[model samples]
Target: MALAGCGTINTVMREDGVAARELKSQKTYCQSIPRVYSGVSYNFCRLNGEPNPDGAFDGHLNFVPFVFVDSLISGILDTALLPYTIYRQSADGSIIIR
Candidate 1:
């Protein structure tokens, strides 16, 4: 005796060339923005628990960590400047600039 299966299997095939062509065209037409990792710097300043007179500036910047040798070199060259300024954050998670 042979046993019978409980469910039936169905298969569908697509033969429309116009729908396939349209789908391909639409897929190619959709574009996306390319992701990039550009180095940028954000500067903020605060003084004596108060906002600084100048506003924060944001621009392209190269970030480098300070080490003993670099610090010595910077001191010799007198090119080191105060790096960052502190600012207050608002309730809405935005930086408050004075």
Candidate 2:
């Protein structure tokens, strides 16, 4: 498995150097934020005593499985997004539908 950056989900930025904002009222905008799973099995294995095995080498493979599973989950998050709903606050500090 090719290790890339440290696995942490971050806000994607726009061309204008501003963080992308997902407007809750807009279905299109809501559909753009991807869902991510927080799993750290790979990190756990690396913390333990386990050698990083090569692709062709046969040894005690500890983190590979977790890495592969995390990769698949990450891929799914990269593509799918769910809509979000929001409510506005009234002058009296009560939440009301805008």
Candidate 3:
């Protein structure tokens, strides 16, 4: 469970430089992302709309099931972090991906 969504864990939970590094490689069109349910949102952002310019499928189809499962786990984690996230959301606003 801990190993799942390693990228998500790095990008969402950690406030250190690790999150920056993790998000650096991702090609997301989102300008500002919500802190609540962020992991699921991140996953959906990657999976949203048509295939990216790089390829037809982007090779992510195979991972759809796994991604759904990860979303569930991430939702739980997000709920657990709600208090802190809510405060962060009010003070800092949404997380900027652009």
TM-score of model number 3: 0.66
Among the numbered candidates, top TM-score falls to 3
- Local distance difference test scores for all models: 0.19, 0.28, 0.58
Estimated TM-score per prediction? 0.15, 0.25, 0.66
- Candidate 2: misplaced stretches above 4 Å? 1-62, 81-98
The lDDT of model 3 is 0.58
Assess candidate 2 and give its TM-score to the true structure. Answer: 0.25
Which sections of candidate 1 miss by over 4 Å? 1-66, 79-98
Error of 3 at 26 (Å): 3.8
Residue-pair clashes per candidate: 2, 0, 0
Task: List model 1 lDDT by residue over 1-43, tens digit each.
Answer: 0001000000001122322232233232212111110001111
- The collision pairs in model 1 are 44-85, 45-85
lDDT of 2: 0.28
lDDT pick, better of 1 and 3: 3
In terms of lDDT, which candidate is stronger, 1 or 2?
A: 2
Model 1 compared with the native: what TM-score?
0.15
